[model samples]
Target: MKTIKILLPIFIYILLVDLSYAQSKQNKKQSLIKPVVEPPIEVERTTPNNPDQYQLRLIMENDAFGGFSDRYYTNGSRLEFHMSAGESNPTRKVFSYWNDLFITPNEKTRYLQGFAVGQEFYTPTNIKKADVSYGDRPYSSRGYFTNSLTTFTEDTSITTELELGMIGPSVGGKSAQINFHNFIGSPTPQGWDTQIPDSYSVALKTDIRKFYHRFFGTQYNVNLGNIQTDVSFGLIFRFGNVDKTPGPGSSALQPGSPILHEDGKGYWYFYVNPGGTLQAYNATIQGQMGSDKAYKSQNRSSAFSNWDSFLNNPTPDVGEKELQYRMLSEDNGKNTLQRYILFNEFLVNGTTNPYNIGLNYLIFNNIFNGAEEIERTTRLFLLSNLSAQWDQIPTNARALAIYSIFRPEGGKLPPIVRYYSYEVLSQFILDPKQRETLLQLLREEAEYRDNKTYIADLKRAVGFIRAGFVSVSNAGFLFGLHYNYQTIDFQAAKGLPQQHQWVGFQLGKVF
Candidate 1:
């Protein structure tokens, strides 16, 4: 009985072991033969037929659009073509690669490309003045070409742009303004002669936005380049109905297709983009890149008693060179040109060369300043004669400074005061008879006196833009108006307007 029991237990144990091993082998074989699967992943593919169309947009902006205004922000016009790269297009891959390199995107985002050619021109409040209005932005203009890419998804979008252009007389700002002004019988600008100098310009720009409910959103934009650089962040408010997200079709993007949510249905809305721009550089307001200027003019013989006198001087009427001799009253001291190069250097993070203007100054003593106006003029005459034989004349700081600001003509110092400053004049100046002759000349000049004197220092400029702008859109047409209570742009004197009003119009149609 014991043996039977032991054999039965061993047989049962063997059978059990065999069965377990066979089951393990079967499971292993099955695992080897079958492929392991990951959780089913959702693949995203672009919707078909979304490309649909291309468009051309004409954007126009001007101070005139605001009416009764023909000054600052004078005119801007651009023609741009925009087209979406359909999912299957070759351009789509190009855009995708470009986007991958610069901006963010997802598989669901749509892409578009834009190309444009444009011009922008600005002037001081007094465009009629044929000189740099010392306190206002000098005449400035730019002509440029731009290439941009945009990636959008539903209510969010990002855009990156590259602009290549030039700023200067070559931009045709003066001619364009003149033609437009003539057509409208408006005051024509005559001071483009001192416009921003010719310089190559390049800039990169990016815009990021998020909109909700199709009525409001926020925008952040940044521009960096030789032409314009700024960071702008603001809120956008819409007061009408459009069945689509305001961003993708927003004209603010590259010339966009009309926000046609439903075919044949017109969409109209008025939007306000209340924003603040932390402006850093503007080539138009400040001088252009590179040298502040190639050459500068100095007071010649300084014979003229007044600007009119300089104009009437028998000096050869050379073109701009002669004109520069009397242009921007940058000659605040009325004797030497004071450069804003240092101030500009601090303002612009660009390369620039300061002018090497050798000092040809007439220094005088402070005592000459305490004296009455009559004595001041007489003593200056004395010093000029004394220095007639020397390379430079030394006078006290106060006397020379006092004499510098007052126009020679305002004191009736007469052009003769300088003309007689030849070496021969020194020999006779000390003689009693010669002194009386000079005194008599001064006395006669007193008859031609006026009240005006030194011009105020040129206003230091900073880049800034703070304003409220309104935009209206209807059936692909856009119009904008800006009422800005300005910042100090460039003022050399007091009393220039501190506020400006202008208009903007952007109209586009798919061609």
Candidate 2:
């Protein structure tokens, strides 16, 4: 009885252990059969296609002058002004403002509102009477009476430009833009004369935006109008963080240095523009003044006097005559000899980031004349530009070449006149150490070219570098010098001192 009892307890214990083992196997099998529940699938968010934003821009410029005048009188000195002519050297001020507003209420649509205004005026200053003459006539005479010929001449002018437009929905990843802008108002001419007629102008432009894949390129724009007709292509590159805004305009990355952004991240782009235009101009008024026989005869003597003296003279017959002569000559008896001009340009912009390069070639033919003459008068232009940002060496360089042939069927001079020009430039940004090295290189080059004809009739080379610090933004400024040279070979004078040379500094923006 005792043995049986012990054997029964042992059998029960074995059965319990077997039961526990079976349950553990069942749980493991169930775990293997169960399905996985992964976290929700992730999706990327994209920027909406709506346009709404505001933009403002301002530009300021100043220039200094020092050169010998063709008339033998000193070019004189004056306070620096923007780019007005008569305000030369005299202190001049200019203000320009541009504002843009964008509104978008739906996807793939946008509207633009823009306004621009500019004002420029010269402070009154003393003036002096100067002599001026015209043509080869030496009969005209005039004089200015004043205290040291110093009189205050003040001129102020303003201009306003406005635009309103809409952009259509993007197609095939490309957008279309159509806009109308009105250019109205009177602005002073470049010189001190400050004389320009008020005029109204309207322009229409159409282009495909972001035509190529993001990296490959942008669009080509076509413009048509009385002022100009041309086509241009742009190369685009971007950098920095992008904003998730409606429309491309507002989404432009903010301006900054050492930009940061990832692939698919919104960024800013810089585009280089290469374009050409066929332009026409009819200075009927000036041409008439140049060819008017009566006006020329009346002002014959005054035409030889200094420009200032002749301008102040009460009986300015020469002025009337010159105006009439120009008018008649331009009319060419048929009432007009339609004048035409052609221009080509290569533009480099790093405003966005990762500078770009572009090149353009243009031809302007005087089609107003017969085909044979047109072939002879054709003008050609070639322009190229480069922009790049490397470690401490950010640089922009440009080259231009222009060739023109002027032919007068009935003039006493040669049947054809040829004019040619070539220019090269480089603008650089350097750290302090790099700047010193660059300056030294420049000095060495200048010394090598000194007293040598680097260019035709070019005798000397001069350069200036300016550095300054401002308190507001603590902005540091560094600007290099302007260099220019000109050489002319006059064919009419033959052996009579027909060669002229001009070399000087132009103080202003580098690009």
Q: Could you estimate the TM-score for every candidate?
A: 0.55, 0.23
User: Ten residues in a row with the worst lDDT in model 2?
Assistant: 172-181
Residues 184-301, candidate 1: write the lDDT tens digits.
Answer: 8775566666576778889877777767767787777778998777776767677665544543333332223222221244455566665556667776766664553522222211
Candidate 2 per-residue lDDT, tens place, 1-511, comes to: 1222323344345435534654675467567663685433212113332212223322221122223222111111111111111111111111122101111112332222222222221110111101011111111101110000011111111111111111111110010000100121212111111111122223333333332333333433344432223453433333222232111211000000011112233333332222222223211111111222212222222111222233343454655644433332221111112322111111123222223222212111211111112222223212222122223222211212122133322111111110011011112222345434444444443343222210011112212111111110112111112222222211111112222222222111100
- Candidate 2 regions exceeding 4 Å error are 1-51, 59-109, 118-191, 205-211, 215-271, 281-511
lDDT of 2 at 106: 28
Cα shift from native, residue 18, model 2 (Å): 87
User: In lDDT terms, which candidate is top?
Assistant: 1
State in Å the error of residue 116, model 1: 0.9
Off by over 4 Å in 1: 1-49, 86-108, 248-266, 294-493
